[model samples]
Target: MFAFVMRRLAVAIPTLLLLIVFSFILMHLAPGGPFSLERELPPQVLANLNAKYGLDDPLWLQIWNYLTGIVLHFDFGPSFVYPDRSVNDLIAAGFPVTLTYGTLRARFKTR
Candidate 1:
């Protein structure tokens, strides 16, 4: 059991890391950014905003910062579209609804 658990952990860690890396890449590659829906601000204001969020850093550095935040703090960081709420907060808030929906679907399917 110990050896089996250890082997699973070894496989799981790399799979999780790859999933994170791919998701990050896909997110960045998609058109539009967090501020895209907002009204145009001055260039100085935009630059300042980017700098404050470390969005101005090189992509690799930004990815490193994000990964460090996740690994060290269990933080997925703030929502890009909802600046006031962190990703964790949003997930917590939505989980109940998700659970309910899944439960109902399964119940109906089995009926």
Candidate 2:
């Protein structure tokens, strides 16, 4: 039983890492960036915004930083859409509603 659990964990860890890396890559490859706006911002301002979020870093470095932040500090950093909030803060705020809906759905599931 212990060996089985360990084997599953070994596979799961790489799977989770691949998922995170692929999602990050896909998001960056999309058309518009988080800072894109109808009216163009000054170059300096755009550079500052990118630097602030570590988006100016090389893609590999960004991924490393993101993974380390999660593994070591459990930090999800800040939300690009909401300058005032961290990703963790947003998740916490919505978690209660999510839990409520999830519980209700499970209780009423057709199966």
Candidate 3:
């Protein structure tokens, strides 16, 4: 049993490393800055927004900031393009709906 668990951990570590490396590479492959949506804003407002989110830094640095944010801050940040609610709040609210859907799906899928 111990050997089985140890083997699983050994396999998982490489998978995690590959996922992180792929995420790093894929992030660079994507187009434009994160603030691409707010381009219509005045320069000063854009600066302020970037500063508020720490987006003024390099991409690697921003990724570090966001990863640290998820680890330490427990703040998932707002839902992108969703004006009415925060991302964390939206997830909290939607969880029940998702659970209900899953239950219904399971009930129907087995039929």
lDDT, candidates in the order shown? 0.88, 0.93, 0.75
Instruction: Report the lDDT of model 3 for residue 72.
Output: 79
TM-score-best of 1 and 2? 2
Q: Give the TM-score of candidate 2.
A: 0.87
Off by over 4 Å in 2: 1-4
Candidate 3 residue 97 Cα shift, in angstroms, is 0.5
Give per-model CA RMSD. 2.6, 1.7, 3.7
Identify the leading candidate in terms of lDDT: 2
lDDT agreement of model 3 with the native? 0.75
lDDT of 2 by residue, 8-104 (tens): 9999999998999999999999997888857778889999999999999999999999999987998999998889999999999999999999999
Error of 1 at 13 (Å): 1.3
Alpha-carbon runs more than 4 Å astray in model 3:
1-29, 32-39
Candidates in descending TM-score order: 2, 1, 3
Candidate maximizing TM-score? 2
Give model 1's TM-score versus the native structure: 0.78
